[model samples]
Target: VFFFLYIYIYILRTIMANLHELPGAQADSVPSAAKTLVWGPGLEANIVLPARFFYIQAVDSSGRNLTASPGEKTFEVKIVSPVEEFTRIWIQVLDRQDGSFLVRYRMYATYTDLYIHILLKNKHVANSPFILNGPVYHEGCDCPQSSGSVWETHMHCPQSFPQIDRDLALYASVDPERNAQEIPQRFGQRQSLCHYTVKSNKVYVKTFGEHVGFRIFMDSILLSLTRKVQLPDMEFFVNLGDWPLEKRKPTEKIHPIFSWCGSNNTRDIVMPTYDLTESVLETMGRVSLDMMSVQANTGPPWPEKNATAFWRGRDSRQERLELVKLSRAHPNMIDAAFTNFFFFKHDESLYGPLVKHVSFFDFFKYKYQINIDGTVAAYRLPYLLAGDSVVLKQDSSYYEHFYNELRPWEHYIPIRADLGDLLEKIQWARDHDEEVKKIALTGQQFARNHLMGDRVFCYYYKLFQEYAKRQVTEPNIREGMELVEQPSDDLFPCSCHRTRVGDTK
Candidate 1:
């Protein structure tokens, strides 16, 4: 009886230890193994959720870690629907301490590659360029074999899509008519943020030009992504070039564009790089100017008139003459070499009210500061190449100042408003994918000749082993991960382990 009781006690303890990590094991606790804690789509992949969602933190296997907040999405999580081409889903795992992730696999809008994480090894490259070709759900239709609609995934918009709005939409709608071109699409009645039935399953979006309302669904995938992005009325940002009569009239030098509609802005389906060359060509013609560039009462290094400056009118005709002198001296200054001076004379009229309200000081700082600050770690080529500045992360100080440290309503924006940036980014990807590929793929002769997906995986896997424990299970990686081992630490291992490594490798 004693022996039997002892044996039973031992068996019970072992069973308890094993079952301790089960779903209902300890209220609200999800174990490492059972928890499919996907964290990121890397730096470039995030539109709705930033990469910080997958930051790194660790605790004992017991899972005791104090968290700063219950949930804050990072790892650039975005769960999107399968709609257009080049669309994909990104994921990773986190420590759940501060909600930092260990590995992140994000979908690059242009590069159809996967960022896979292997245990006790480095990451492998996954070809994610292919869009969903499987049957998509319409809910409005029947079940599996029903009259459900399927997406062919042909839409491949650029990386940085411009902010879509009524003006822009209307512009695109009428643009084809304006240029007498063929219109390819019928405007869908899709509203942004339109909700759908919630079900827990893998959701993948196809491309940049999915329904406008689709952005609301981005956070639903990364449940931790809760920050709502309210769109800012940017009619003001667009009208910044219209200076009061002091300078030239505001003609759309920097007009909004739709990549789909080629240069003439027609609704012509374009290949990826077509619009990029056009945009770069257009921007090269115009330059960014600011208060620093503005000429003040005191002359700078050179006292000749700068074309652009602030003007104050005087009651005396003599003062008026002096103003004319200033304008004459700086004729090429306030306005460019090409405009009609009549626009400035028309000022205090069309451009005055618009100019008075617009300072741009606030906007410039945020554009430069926030964009620069947030993208510190990712500033490296993987996040962006040099040309695609829109998605290219700025500095983190900007992110800290604008987001973490700044008060509400001051340079404040939501994830939704980011749609503008999102579209623009997608456009950039579409436009500059080749240049980006060159940068990502080019390094040494080895990189040039051998840096395909598998080799890249091996290189990263070697790094992962040196830095962290990553295991490769995707079968694609099994051979690569096995062959490489850290040699410095172990000159030799036991014969059995060596044989095992030999067999596996």
Candidate 2:
């Protein structure tokens, strides 16, 4: 009986010991895998200059570190190819006390490609490449500081500001039967006569041909600034250019609000305004810009596309109407149709062979796509070029932010504003199939590289920085939460673990 009791006690103790080891055994059985790499706090694919310090944290599948020792891990940061000597130095890895690590460096100019690599116990853990856009500042240039009088000068308009009312009244009195070219040109000429130039320091504020609405004008300028710079609220920093003008006209019970239009006031700014600003950027609202390459993913491959040239738009301008006539004359070569009758309800009878509206993506089905300007440069140019179709772009006086950077014929086939050479251009493209395809490829690549939302943001950031320098008084915009409550180290890691390297305070 004594021997049996002793054996029973030993068995019970053995079971308890195994149970104690169960937790450790289960932990060892689970696979420790690093899943994703995340950017630092408030850090995105777009990074502006003077923002040198930020971190990239690597986490396991469970969102926790597999190990918490710097001695047991490896971290490296590298600026990707075409790296200039100016950007080569100062990029270094900080001690990874926990799972989180730091990459600190100052950029002289913009860099689109930057990479980070991490390893745990000699095994590759995480790798990522990101974009950083910096303002181009030249050394030895005596840059003027911002001041008060500059704001007054930029906001001031010509003495003939009241003439806009007269121009509108005269435009209304003009006979609708007048030649299509006569009305727009006559109004444009009158507007040009009414224009005046105001200068504050070296910066000048001049009028464009027509009056773009106050809301659209203000929104576009702010969007370009906010989309790129993570700075103070521009609303707080700067006064609306139109607000002062409106206040000055106290006798007018109601200010004349113009229809949506484009601006030459923003010409020096170099970026063009899009009709879809509200839909695309959600600048004033919460709309997120869709970054996916829609043209490549949704459109049919180049080989399967139709050989005919295609165009579609509302009857907004004389050039567009001419395009419709050309399409009807050469139906086989050109497929053009009215997509909307919103602006020209009375002219419905004039439209012949109009088809139901088709999605913009459908335009990519044809091998050749025609891009013509609406009010200014048609905002669709970028979206059209994104596709695999070769673009026959009508030359216009208007240009967008990146228009200066693009090469004609190399990136797209250029046609005159009159579009008289449309048929000839189409035939040339048809005969040179390989060359047309190459142009399409080139255009697509250019759009992807330069017209991406991140790239656009960078362009605006640089423009605003330069614009701000011209001002006599600094903008009075309110600072954001991130800037106000900047972290103790001046950097915040998304992860809980953090290591301090220097006196960030």
Candidate 3:
């Protein structure tokens, strides 16, 4: 009888231990709504973006953190106006599958105070119904204005402010003999160039080439920006190509031209690309400036992602081809491949079997992302830096407006143009795991702070403001120019919406 009792006790203990090790163990550990924790920047009421975010962590009855998601429907978040109970706001709860949840909500134009309720399994979280001051803006659909006083000045723009003045100075003096007003008329008709004028905050365009889409997209951004700030009347020529217009070496003299990107050798005034600010995601619709922060916040934590370096793109440059060879030589360290092979089609067998296109978010799965220049500057650099993974960018002269602010080791790991130092850098990343993770996080924070839609608009406003200061004569709408109307909210229903309160006139 004594032996049998001992056996029974041992068997019961084993069963309990096995149950604790099972996948459903979290189910047994019921989340205590009262003990759950909630915090993050999204909780702040005065944030400039229309979207607000906060984090929630599940805890048990004993206040211990839960290791996994409790359930899909476990956490519930609701944002409601305190004064008007009927007021509705859009709210989303993203489960990180690690006992934590990211809650995002859209801010609407309302005078009353707002309250955010966080609940787990129908019970209130530790700080449920957190109160926040309503947004001060009058329009519901418009981008929220910064409450801080420094937003309009160059101080509110990126660190590239000095570069803006220098680029404008390149065109500060046109050909001494030519009239200032005639400069656009003489050079605007060139291929891949367009003349743009802002009269009373409206964008007017005259296309000289087939790249009308670029002008339309840029005008859309300008229109969105003008709604928030009143830009001085200005006219400028825009180069709509991968190469800067000044670099093209037309027989005519170099003129001040705005470009999406520029090189160290080029004198083009670089501006933000619509592709960087508002690229469309397959799952998520048009990703606007406001949604950029939210998208950047997505993806797994650093430790949970793959440790190998990842690269995927077309065969746009020889450096990219060499990267694939290096990856093949060191498969364990890197995973590089071409998704399309046009430039080197003759060597198809050498790098054949093009891989399928990977989703942008999936790129975050790797510990390090390889950013190689395609034509000029890889437009994907901004989006890559926005992710949680560290970017191993190839050194290139080509740069965007904000590249001046990005420090090499501080923001990203710089690789050689030929990718010769890439292996060494990857090994270094492996050796200093914590340091690389910090760099990744710091880069992400930099992007979130500077590359957002609001900041892009601010950069444009500052650039145009500086350009307006140097105008020799008043800008007038030229013949053949057409008005580029602002895009409607219906086009970007996911990021933009019309509130019941009314539109800002």
Candidate 4:
């Protein structure tokens, strides 16, 4: 019996040795968890944003690269939060079919360390349980305060600013002979531009425009942003008009003037409009009673809401007039009307008997909300999306800063520039009740996630950070630019003040 056992062991050893000698043999190229490598920006523990990613390359036990896929199912990746041990964060592993995998994950919770477990064939890989130190973000998803140095180095949010970055580059690439200070002076429109300067995290503004109300709100937002985070010293022009100031020309140098909205031909750096009433007021450390009322009034649920699309705004565009006419024709499907009319005052009879202004929150009483551009991209779209109703937006060339991130069917239902498809789309929405409701919920969630007060400030902070990098010359306050002081605590009703008072106790 001992002699037979010895013979069997000898035969097994000889077969294994022969297999190792053969080229590309399965027995010789088995995947080793220890040899496999994982590395990328996503592996960084200081990541504050949701989207994080890393790459995994499979290697053999002999430390040789595998040329083909070993099957994605063979690898398992998980990101587990210590606070929520039972709940595992969902991770996506995309097989490259080339012995590599791309693993993606999103951090949903705040102030919780995460453990990343990477396993190959249920065996622990090299650096298997990676502990990621979470950040402590402020209320409303503000910048993480736990690591100031990390925030300074990574001075950007997860959102992409393609157009803004492009325009910044264009402005930065000015003629060497032309002075940077002269660029703002040459393009500054007295009726639209507001020159602003930041010094030691304090914001000061000088209005070149007639829109004092708009300028005040814009500067207030800047001041509020500085209070939340330390901004670099910089000075730039902001256009408070519906139209962008910079028109790109091959021969002429383009001045990088910031604006609330932009189109295909414009190169203005777009920022969030000051017209977002709730966000603007909250940023300024103030909240009006009307805003409070709107917050409390969430409107009815999907089933209880009126089964018609609703829109009430000033007639500023031809498409808006057409919407009113369509609503009059198909009153059952749409309830659109002009609250005020200046563009077509002569044709009052055609689209008249101006409807009284409806509270912004009341628009959510209907299942669908219509968002037609007024002059430029309608600033109300963000506020409209914050409601509990789906938005049927008209197609247009104009766009805000966050427009690129929004998907048509996923976040909103798109309607043509003409009202020809309005009725049909409304009917389609009615037929697919559950789908439209989901769309409404998604749009609302987007606004809650990206357009909140803190996120808005974060966007402003990031925009200026990119702008600062592109400036050929240092930003300094110029002649006639007045200092806009921060308002006193008693002047506005602030939620932060209450927190301070409670802390003192």
Best-fitting candidate, scored by TM-score: 3
Candidate 3 root-mean-square deviation in Å: 6.5
Model 1 Cα lDDT, one tens digit per residue, 28-132? 232232222332213222121112112233222355432222232322233344344434434544322232233333332322222333221121112222123
Q: Give the TM-score of candidate 2.
A: 0.49
* Residue range 71-157, candidate 4, lDDT tens digits: 768689877777765542446676644466667654333435667899987888888887767542222333323332345455445
Query: Total clashes, candidate 2?
Result: 9
lDDT tens digits, residue span 1-505, model 2 = 9999999999998886676346433232222335535454113322322223345455544554422333323555555434554443345454333344445443333333444433444445543444433222111111222322332232121222122332233222222123122323433443421111112211112233444333344344343332222322121111112211112232333222222232332212233344333333432134322222243233565677899999888887788888888887899999998877665667667775567888766777799999998756777777777776899998876655556667888999999989989999999999999999999889977875655443443443343333334333333211221121111322211221122212145
TM-score of each: 0.21, 0.49, 0.74, 0.64
Which stretches of candidate 2 lie above 4 Å from their native place? 1-268, 275-293, 296-298, 342-346, 473-505
Ranking by lDDT: 3, 4, 2, 1
Clashing pairs in model 4? none
Per-residue accuracy of model 3 over 273-381 as CA lDDT, tens digit each: 6576454111123454333443434467777889899999999888888888988899999999999988889877897679999877788789999999997888888
lDDT, candidate 3, at 217: 61
Q: Which parts of model 1 have CA positions greater than 4 angstroms off? A: 1-36, 39-97, 102-163, 169-177, 180-256, 259-505
Model 2 Cα shift for residue 118 (angstroms): 15
Single out the weakest 10-residue window by summed lDDT for candidate 1: 236-245
For candidate 2, the per-residue lDDT at 122 reads 47
